[model samples]
Target: MSEVFERYERQYCELSANLSKKCTAAGALDGEQKKQKISEVKAGIDEAESLIRKMDLEARSLQPNVKAVLLVKLREYKSDLNNLKTEVKRLSSGGNYLSARDDLLESGMADTLTASADQRSRLMTTTETLNQSGNRIKESKRTMLETEELGVSILQDLHQQRQSLLHANNTLHGVDDNVGKSKKILTSISRRMNRNKWIIGSIIAVVIVAIILILYFKLK
Candidate 1:
Protein backbone atom coordinates (compact mmCIF):
# COMPACT_ATOMS: atom_id res chain seq x y z
CA MET A 1 0.00 0.00 0.00
CA SER A 2 2.84 2.37 0.82
CA GLU A 3 4.41 1.28 -2.45
CA VAL A 4 1.30 2.59 -4.19
CA PHE A 5 1.58 5.87 -2.29
CA GLU A 6 5.25 6.21 -3.21
CA ARG A 7 4.51 5.67 -6.90
CA TYR A 8 1.80 8.32 -6.80
CA GLU A 9 4.11 10.78 -5.05
CA ARG A 10 6.74 10.33 -7.74
CA GLN A 11 4.19 10.78 -10.50
CA TYR A 12 2.84 13.88 -8.80
CA CYS A 13 6.32 15.36 -8.59
CA GLU A 14 6.94 14.50 -12.22
CA LEU A 15 3.72 16.19 -13.26
CA SER A 16 4.69 19.31 -11.37
CA ALA A 17 8.08 19.27 -13.07
CA ASN A 18 6.43 18.88 -16.47
CA LEU A 19 4.07 21.76 -15.81
CA SER A 20 6.97 23.92 -14.63
CA LYS A 21 8.92 23.02 -17.75
CA LYS A 22 5.95 24.03 -19.87
CA CYS A 23 5.67 27.41 -18.10
CA THR A 24 9.41 28.07 -18.48
CA ALA A 25 9.38 26.98 -22.12
CA ALA A 26 6.60 29.52 -22.68
CA GLY A 27 8.84 32.33 -21.33
CA ALA A 28 6.91 32.92 -18.12
CA LEU A 29 10.09 34.02 -16.37
CA ASP A 30 8.72 36.13 -13.54
CA GLY A 31 5.98 33.71 -12.60
CA GLU A 32 7.50 30.45 -13.83
CA GLN A 33 8.63 29.43 -10.38
CA LYS A 34 5.28 30.28 -8.84
CA LYS A 35 3.40 28.43 -11.54
CA GLN A 36 5.68 25.44 -11.00
CA LYS A 37 4.87 25.48 -7.31
CA ILE A 38 1.14 25.51 -8.01
CA SER A 39 1.65 22.75 -10.51
CA GLU A 40 3.40 20.70 -7.84
CA VAL A 41 0.44 21.05 -5.53
CA LYS A 42 -1.94 20.11 -8.33
CA ALA A 43 0.23 17.08 -9.11
CA GLY A 44 -0.14 16.01 -5.51
CA ILE A 45 -3.85 15.57 -6.17
CA ASP A 46 -3.00 13.25 -9.04
CA GLU A 47 -0.64 11.28 -6.84
CA ALA A 48 -3.28 10.80 -4.20
CA GLU A 49 -5.75 9.57 -6.80
CA SER A 50 -3.28 7.00 -8.13
CA LEU A 51 -2.59 5.73 -4.65
CA ILE A 52 -6.26 5.48 -3.88
CA ARG A 53 -6.84 3.31 -6.91
CA LYS A 54 -3.89 1.10 -6.08
CA MET A 55 -5.06 0.75 -2.50
CA ASP A 56 -8.55 -0.18 -3.59
CA LEU A 57 -7.20 -2.93 -5.81
CA GLU A 58 -4.87 -4.21 -3.12
CA ALA A 59 -7.48 -4.09 -0.41
CA ARG A 60 -10.03 -6.23 -2.23
CA SER A 61 -8.75 -9.53 -0.78
CA LEU A 62 -7.85 -8.13 2.60
CA GLN A 63 -9.89 -8.43 5.81
CA PRO A 64 -13.03 -6.36 6.40
CA ASN A 65 -11.36 -3.80 8.64
CA VAL A 66 -8.61 -3.22 6.08
CA LYS A 67 -11.16 -3.00 3.28
CA ALA A 68 -13.21 -0.41 5.17
CA VAL A 69 -10.36 2.08 5.52
CA LEU A 70 -9.28 1.64 1.92
CA LEU A 71 -12.84 2.06 0.69
CA VAL A 72 -13.25 5.32 2.60
CA LYS A 73 -10.00 6.66 1.21
CA LEU A 74 -10.96 5.58 -2.29
CA ARG A 75 -14.27 7.39 -2.03
CA GLU A 76 -12.60 10.55 -0.77
CA TYR A 77 -10.04 10.46 -3.53
CA LYS A 78 -12.73 9.94 -6.16
CA SER A 79 -14.71 12.88 -4.85
CA ASP A 80 -11.60 15.02 -5.03
CA LEU A 81 -10.83 13.78 -8.52
CA ASN A 82 -14.28 14.86 -9.71
CA ASN A 83 -13.83 18.31 -8.21
CA LEU A 84 -10.35 18.58 -9.74
CA LYS A 85 -11.78 17.65 -13.13
CA THR A 86 -14.29 20.46 -12.89
CA GLU A 87 -11.50 22.87 -12.00
CA VAL A 88 -9.33 21.60 -14.83
CA LYS A 89 -12.13 22.14 -17.32
CA ARG A 90 -12.71 25.64 -16.01
CA LEU A 91 -9.02 26.59 -16.24
CA SER A 92 -8.47 24.88 -19.57
CA SER A 93 -11.47 26.56 -21.16
CA GLY A 94 -10.38 29.98 -19.95
CA GLY A 95 -6.80 29.35 -21.08
CA ASN A 96 -8.00 28.23 -24.50
CA TYR A 97 -10.27 31.24 -24.88
CA LEU A 98 -7.47 33.58 -23.91
CA SER A 99 -5.21 31.87 -26.42
CA ALA A 100 -7.84 32.33 -29.09
CA ARG A 101 -8.22 35.98 -28.10
CA ASP A 102 -4.49 36.51 -28.50
CA ASP A 103 -4.62 34.89 -31.93
CA LEU A 104 -7.47 37.15 -32.95
CA LEU A 105 -5.56 40.24 -31.83
CA GLU A 106 -2.50 39.11 -33.73
CA SER A 107 -4.57 38.46 -36.89
CA GLY A 108 -5.03 42.24 -37.35
CA MET A 109 -8.67 41.97 -38.36
CA ALA A 110 -10.31 45.31 -37.63
CA ASP A 111 -13.85 43.90 -37.77
CA THR A 112 -13.03 40.67 -35.96
CA LEU A 113 -11.12 42.44 -33.20
CA THR A 114 -14.32 44.07 -31.93
CA ALA A 115 -16.15 40.75 -32.04
CA SER A 116 -13.20 39.04 -30.40
CA ALA A 117 -13.28 41.54 -27.55
CA ASP A 118 -16.91 40.74 -27.03
CA GLN A 119 -16.06 37.06 -26.83
CA ARG A 120 -13.25 37.85 -24.42
CA SER A 121 -15.68 39.77 -22.25
CA ARG A 122 -17.94 36.75 -22.09
CA LEU A 123 -14.96 34.67 -21.05
CA MET A 124 -14.28 37.16 -18.27
CA THR A 125 -17.59 36.26 -16.60
CA THR A 126 -16.08 32.83 -16.16
CA THR A 127 -13.20 34.44 -14.30
CA GLU A 128 -14.62 33.51 -10.96
CA THR A 129 -15.01 29.99 -12.20
CA LEU A 130 -11.33 29.93 -13.07
CA ASN A 131 -10.31 31.29 -9.69
CA GLN A 132 -12.61 28.90 -7.91
CA SER A 133 -11.19 26.06 -9.95
CA GLY A 134 -7.66 26.95 -8.92
CA ASN A 135 -8.71 27.02 -5.32
CA ARG A 136 -10.48 23.71 -5.67
CA ILE A 137 -7.43 22.13 -7.25
CA LYS A 138 -5.33 23.40 -4.38
CA GLU A 139 -7.86 22.20 -1.88
CA SER A 140 -7.86 18.78 -3.50
CA LYS A 141 -4.10 18.62 -3.15
CA ARG A 142 -4.36 19.29 0.53
CA THR A 143 -7.09 16.70 0.80
CA MET A 144 -4.79 14.24 -0.94
CA LEU A 145 -2.09 14.86 1.64
CA GLU A 146 -4.65 14.21 4.33
CA THR A 147 -5.64 11.06 2.54
CA GLU A 148 -2.02 9.93 2.47
CA GLU A 149 -1.77 10.46 6.17
CA LEU A 150 -4.94 8.52 6.65
CA GLY A 151 -3.45 5.75 4.53
CA VAL A 152 -0.45 5.53 6.86
CA SER A 153 -2.83 5.17 9.76
CA ILE A 154 -4.77 2.47 7.94
CA LEU A 155 -1.60 0.64 6.97
CA GLN A 156 -0.51 0.62 10.60
CA ASP A 157 -3.91 -0.78 11.49
CA LEU A 158 -3.53 -3.43 8.81
CA HIS A 159 -0.14 -4.41 10.18
CA GLN A 160 -1.63 -4.83 13.64
CA GLN A 161 -4.52 -6.83 12.27
CA ARG A 162 -2.15 -9.09 10.35
CA GLN A 163 -0.20 -9.75 13.49
CA SER A 164 -3.36 -10.84 15.35
CA LEU A 165 -4.59 -12.99 12.45
CA LEU A 166 -1.15 -14.37 11.61
CA HIS A 167 -1.61 -13.51 7.94
CA ALA A 168 1.46 -15.05 6.29
CA ASN A 169 1.50 -12.95 3.17
CA ASN A 170 4.73 -11.72 1.59
CA THR A 171 4.70 -8.35 -0.14
CA LEU A 172 6.45 -9.85 -3.16
CA HIS A 173 3.80 -12.56 -3.59
CA GLY A 174 1.90 -10.72 -6.35
CA VAL A 175 4.86 -9.00 -8.00
CA ASP A 176 5.86 -10.37 -11.41
CA ASP A 177 9.65 -10.48 -11.53
CA ASN A 178 9.82 -11.62 -15.16
CA VAL A 179 8.14 -8.49 -16.55
CA GLY A 180 11.15 -7.71 -18.76
CA LYS A 181 11.23 -11.31 -20.00
CA SER A 182 7.53 -11.18 -20.72
CA LYS A 183 8.03 -7.97 -22.72
CA LYS A 184 10.80 -9.62 -24.74
CA ILE A 185 8.54 -12.60 -25.44
CA LEU A 186 5.75 -10.29 -26.57
CA THR A 187 8.12 -8.44 -28.90
CA SER A 188 9.28 -11.74 -30.42
CA ILE A 189 5.68 -12.80 -30.96
CA SER A 190 4.85 -9.49 -32.63
CA ARG A 191 7.83 -9.82 -34.94
CA ARG A 192 6.76 -13.31 -35.95
CA MET A 193 3.21 -12.09 -36.61
CA ASN A 194 4.52 -9.23 -38.78
CA ARG A 195 6.67 -11.69 -40.79
CA ASN A 196 3.51 -13.62 -41.70
CA LYS A 197 2.07 -10.44 -43.27
CA TRP A 198 4.85 -10.31 -45.90
CA ILE A 199 4.70 -14.07 -46.41
CA ILE A 200 1.04 -13.78 -47.49
CA GLY A 201 1.97 -11.05 -50.01
CA SER A 202 4.79 -13.22 -51.41
CA ILE A 203 2.44 -16.18 -51.72
CA ILE A 204 -0.10 -14.07 -53.62
CA ALA A 205 2.61 -12.81 -55.97
CA VAL A 206 3.82 -16.37 -56.69
CA VAL A 207 0.26 -17.57 -57.36
CA ILE A 208 -0.35 -14.74 -59.82
CA VAL A 209 2.93 -15.50 -61.60
CA ALA A 210 2.06 -19.19 -61.84
CA ILE A 211 -1.42 -18.41 -63.26
CA ILE A 212 0.11 -16.14 -65.95
CA LEU A 213 2.63 -18.83 -66.94
CA ILE A 214 -0.16 -21.44 -67.18
CA LEU A 215 -2.32 -19.10 -69.30
CA TYR A 216 0.59 -18.26 -71.60
CA PHE A 217 1.42 -21.93 -72.17
CA LYS A 218 -2.27 -22.79 -72.84
CA LEU A 219 -2.55 -19.97 -75.38
CA LYS A 220 0.64 -21.02 -77.14
Candidate 2:
Protein backbone atom coordinates (compact mmCIF):
# COMPACT_ATOMS: atom_id res chain seq x y z
CA MET A 1 0.00 0.00 0.00
CA SER A 2 2.80 2.34 0.85
CA GLU A 3 4.42 1.43 -2.44
CA VAL A 4 1.23 2.28 -4.30
CA PHE A 5 1.04 5.62 -2.52
CA GLU A 6 4.63 6.36 -3.37
CA ARG A 7 4.03 5.47 -7.00
CA TYR A 8 1.10 7.85 -7.17
CA GLU A 9 3.15 10.53 -5.46
CA ARG A 10 5.91 10.20 -8.01
CA GLN A 11 3.47 10.33 -10.91
CA TYR A 12 1.81 13.39 -9.45
CA CYS A 13 5.16 15.14 -8.99
CA GLU A 14 6.11 14.50 -12.60
CA LEU A 15 2.74 15.64 -13.86
CA SER A 16 2.86 18.75 -11.68
CA ALA A 17 6.33 19.63 -12.90
CA ASN A 18 5.30 19.16 -16.50
CA LEU A 19 2.23 21.31 -15.98
CA SER A 20 4.32 24.01 -14.37
CA LYS A 21 6.71 23.97 -17.28
CA LYS A 22 3.86 24.22 -19.74
CA CYS A 23 2.23 27.04 -17.82
CA THR A 24 5.51 28.91 -17.79
CA ALA A 25 6.09 28.30 -21.47
CA ALA A 26 2.54 29.27 -22.36
CA GLY A 27 3.35 32.93 -21.79
CA ALA A 28 6.17 32.85 -24.36
CA LEU A 29 4.27 30.92 -27.02
CA ASP A 30 2.15 32.42 -29.80
CA GLY A 31 -1.29 31.54 -31.17
CA GLU A 32 -1.69 27.77 -31.67
CA GLN A 33 1.25 26.80 -29.52
CA LYS A 34 -0.16 28.67 -26.54
CA LYS A 35 -3.58 27.03 -26.96
CA GLN A 36 -1.97 23.60 -27.29
CA LYS A 37 0.05 24.05 -24.14
CA ILE A 38 -3.02 25.16 -22.24
CA SER A 39 -4.92 22.12 -23.45
CA GLU A 40 -2.11 19.85 -22.30
CA VAL A 41 -2.14 21.50 -18.92
CA LYS A 42 -5.88 20.94 -18.67
CA ALA A 43 -5.39 17.28 -19.46
CA GLY A 44 -2.66 17.07 -16.85
CA ILE A 45 -4.97 18.63 -14.29
CA ASP A 46 -7.62 15.98 -14.96
CA GLU A 47 -5.04 13.25 -14.56
CA ALA A 48 -3.84 14.76 -11.34
CA GLU A 49 -7.37 14.90 -9.95
CA SER A 50 -7.93 11.29 -10.92
CA LEU A 51 -4.68 10.25 -9.27
CA ILE A 52 -5.58 12.10 -6.09
CA ARG A 53 -8.95 10.36 -5.95
CA LYS A 54 -7.22 7.02 -6.37
CA MET A 55 -4.91 7.92 -3.53
CA ASP A 56 -7.92 8.76 -1.38
CA LEU A 57 -9.45 5.35 -2.03
CA GLU A 58 -6.16 3.66 -1.27
CA ALA A 59 -5.91 5.57 1.97
CA ARG A 60 -9.25 4.10 3.10
CA SER A 61 -7.61 0.68 3.31
CA LEU A 62 -4.94 1.88 5.68
CA GLN A 63 -5.08 2.09 9.46
CA PRO A 64 -6.97 5.12 10.68
CA ASN A 65 -3.95 6.94 12.02
CA VAL A 66 -1.95 6.29 8.88
CA LYS A 67 -4.89 7.14 6.62
CA ALA A 68 -5.35 10.42 8.43
CA VAL A 69 -1.73 11.40 7.85
CA LEU A 70 -1.84 10.42 4.18
CA LEU A 71 -5.12 12.30 3.67
CA VAL A 72 -3.51 15.45 5.02
CA LYS A 73 -0.70 15.16 2.49
CA LEU A 74 -3.17 14.41 -0.29
CA ARG A 75 -5.20 17.49 0.62
CA GLU A 76 -2.11 19.65 0.37
CA TYR A 77 -1.30 18.14 -2.98
CA LYS A 78 -4.85 18.83 -4.14
CA SER A 79 -4.56 22.43 -3.04
CA ASP A 80 -1.30 22.81 -4.90
CA LEU A 81 -2.84 21.33 -8.00
CA ASN A 82 -5.75 23.74 -7.70
CA ASN A 83 -3.35 26.67 -7.58
CA LEU A 84 -1.56 25.43 -10.66
CA LYS A 85 -4.86 24.99 -12.44
CA THR A 86 -5.89 28.50 -11.51
CA GLU A 87 -2.66 29.87 -12.91
CA VAL A 88 -3.05 27.86 -16.11
CA LYS A 89 -6.68 28.93 -16.52
CA ARG A 90 -5.81 32.58 -16.04
CA LEU A 91 -3.04 32.33 -18.57
CA SER A 92 -5.27 30.58 -21.06
CA SER A 93 -8.24 32.93 -20.70
CA GLY A 94 -6.29 36.16 -20.66
CA GLY A 95 -7.79 38.34 -23.41
CA ASN A 96 -9.60 35.34 -24.92
CA TYR A 97 -13.04 36.99 -24.76
CA LEU A 98 -11.67 40.26 -26.14
CA SER A 99 -9.93 38.42 -28.94
CA ALA A 100 -13.13 36.57 -29.82
CA ARG A 101 -15.14 39.80 -29.93
CA ASP A 102 -12.51 41.54 -32.05
CA ASP A 103 -12.50 38.68 -34.52
CA LEU A 104 -16.28 38.69 -34.77
CA LEU A 105 -16.32 42.44 -35.32
CA GLU A 106 -13.54 42.36 -37.92
CA SER A 107 -15.08 39.56 -40.01
CA GLY A 108 -16.51 42.17 -42.43
CA MET A 109 -19.73 40.21 -42.64
CA ALA A 110 -23.33 41.55 -42.47
CA ASP A 111 -24.80 42.16 -39.03
CA THR A 112 -27.35 39.35 -39.39
CA LEU A 113 -24.65 36.98 -40.64
CA THR A 114 -22.41 37.73 -37.69
CA ALA A 115 -25.25 37.17 -35.28
CA SER A 116 -26.06 33.80 -36.86
CA ALA A 117 -22.40 32.73 -36.81
CA ASP A 118 -21.98 33.82 -33.23
CA GLN A 119 -25.11 31.91 -32.27
CA ARG A 120 -23.77 28.76 -33.90
CA SER A 121 -20.42 29.12 -32.19
CA ARG A 122 -22.05 29.61 -28.83
CA LEU A 123 -24.29 26.59 -29.40
CA MET A 124 -21.31 24.38 -30.25
CA THR A 125 -19.46 25.55 -27.18
CA THR A 126 -22.44 24.85 -24.96
CA THR A 127 -22.81 21.38 -26.41
CA GLU A 128 -19.18 20.56 -25.77
CA THR A 129 -19.43 21.84 -22.23
CA LEU A 130 -22.50 19.70 -21.62
CA ASN A 131 -20.74 16.63 -22.92
CA GLN A 132 -17.81 17.25 -20.65
CA SER A 133 -20.18 17.65 -17.73
CA GLY A 134 -21.84 14.35 -18.59
CA ASN A 135 -18.52 12.60 -18.66
CA ARG A 136 -17.63 14.06 -15.28
CA ILE A 137 -20.94 12.89 -13.87
CA LYS A 138 -20.29 9.36 -15.05
CA GLU A 139 -16.88 9.37 -13.51
CA SER A 140 -18.32 10.62 -10.24
CA LYS A 141 -20.90 7.82 -10.25
CA ARG A 142 -18.17 5.23 -10.73
CA THR A 143 -16.15 6.65 -7.88
CA MET A 144 -19.20 6.58 -5.64
CA LEU A 145 -19.82 2.93 -6.41
CA GLU A 146 -16.27 2.00 -5.54
CA THR A 147 -16.50 3.91 -2.29
CA GLU A 148 -19.72 2.11 -1.47
CA GLU A 149 -18.08 -1.22 -2.03
CA LEU A 150 -15.29 -0.31 0.30
CA GLY A 151 -17.77 0.78 2.92
CA VAL A 152 -19.57 -2.54 2.63
CA SER A 153 -16.33 -4.43 3.02
CA ILE A 154 -15.45 -2.52 6.16
CA LEU A 155 -18.92 -3.17 7.54
CA GLN A 156 -18.52 -6.88 6.90
CA ASP A 157 -15.29 -6.92 8.84
CA LEU A 158 -16.97 -5.15 11.72
CA HIS A 159 -19.80 -7.68 11.65
CA GLN A 160 -17.35 -10.55 11.85
CA GLN A 161 -15.54 -8.94 14.76
CA ARG A 162 -18.87 -8.46 16.50
CA GLN A 163 -19.66 -12.13 16.10
CA SER A 164 -16.29 -13.10 17.53
CA LEU A 165 -16.77 -10.87 20.54
CA LEU A 166 -20.23 -12.30 21.16
CA HIS A 167 -18.90 -15.85 21.03
CA ALA A 168 -16.13 -15.00 23.47
CA ASN A 169 -18.64 -13.41 25.81
CA ASN A 170 -20.85 -16.53 25.73
CA THR A 171 -17.87 -18.73 26.47
CA LEU A 172 -16.98 -16.57 29.46
CA HIS A 173 -20.52 -16.79 30.75
CA GLY A 174 -20.41 -20.59 30.52
CA VAL A 175 -17.15 -20.62 32.46
CA ASP A 176 -18.64 -18.44 35.16
CA ASP A 177 -21.66 -20.74 35.54
CA ASN A 178 -19.42 -23.78 35.86
CA VAL A 179 -17.34 -22.01 38.50
CA GLY A 180 -20.46 -21.17 40.49
CA LYS A 181 -21.62 -24.78 40.49
CA SER A 182 -18.20 -25.98 41.57
CA LYS A 183 -18.16 -23.50 44.45
CA LYS A 184 -21.60 -24.68 45.64
CA ILE A 185 -20.50 -28.29 45.61
CA LEU A 186 -17.40 -27.40 47.58
CA THR A 187 -19.47 -25.58 50.22
CA SER A 188 -21.81 -28.56 50.66
CA ILE A 189 -18.90 -30.93 51.14
CA SER A 190 -17.26 -28.62 53.64
CA ARG A 191 -20.45 -28.35 55.70
CA ARG A 192 -20.91 -32.10 55.78
CA MET A 193 -17.32 -32.63 56.94
CA ASN A 194 -17.79 -30.12 59.78
CA ARG A 195 -21.01 -31.80 60.92
CA ASN A 196 -19.26 -35.18 60.98
CA LYS A 197 -16.50 -33.78 63.20
CA TRP A 198 -19.05 -32.42 65.72
CA ILE A 199 -20.89 -35.79 65.89
CA ILE A 200 -17.66 -37.67 66.58
CA GLY A 201 -16.67 -35.28 69.42
CA SER A 202 -20.11 -35.58 71.07
CA ILE A 203 -19.96 -39.40 70.96
CA ILE A 204 -16.57 -39.42 72.72
CA ALA A 205 -17.86 -37.10 75.50
CA VAL A 206 -20.91 -39.32 76.20
CA VAL A 207 -18.77 -42.43 76.39
CA ILE A 208 -16.41 -40.78 78.95
CA VAL A 209 -19.29 -39.55 81.11
CA ALA A 210 -20.98 -43.00 81.19
CA ILE A 211 -17.72 -44.69 82.19
CA ILE A 212 -17.32 -42.30 85.16
CA LEU A 213 -20.94 -42.95 86.29
CA ILE A 214 -20.40 -46.69 86.14
CA LEU A 215 -17.30 -46.43 88.42
CA TYR A 216 -19.08 -44.09 90.79
CA PHE A 217 -22.08 -46.51 91.25
CA LYS A 218 -19.78 -49.44 91.82
CA LEU A 219 -17.84 -47.58 94.45
CA LYS A 220 -21.05 -46.58 96.31
lDDT of each: 0.53, 0.73
Candidate 1: segments with Cα more than 4 A from true spot: 1-49, 95-220
> For model 1, how does the per-residue alpha-carbon lDDT over 1-220 read when each residue is reduced to its tens digit?
3334334433433443344334223322224553554465466556646655675676665778867865664564454445444433333332433343343344443244354334334433433455567679889999999999999999999999988655434434433546667888999999999999899989999999999999999999
RMSD (Å) per prediction: 37.5, 16.3
Per-candidate TM vs. native? 0.27, 0.43
Tens digits of per-residue lDDT, candidate 2, 102-167, equal: 433454423533443344344345445655776798899999999999999999999999999999
Candidate 1 — worst ten consecutive residues by lDDT sum?
21-30
The best candidate by TM-score is 2
Pairs that collide in candidate 2 are none
Candidate 2's C-alpha runs over 4 A off are 96-220
lDDT of 2: 0.73
Q: In candidate 1, which residue pairs clash?
A: none
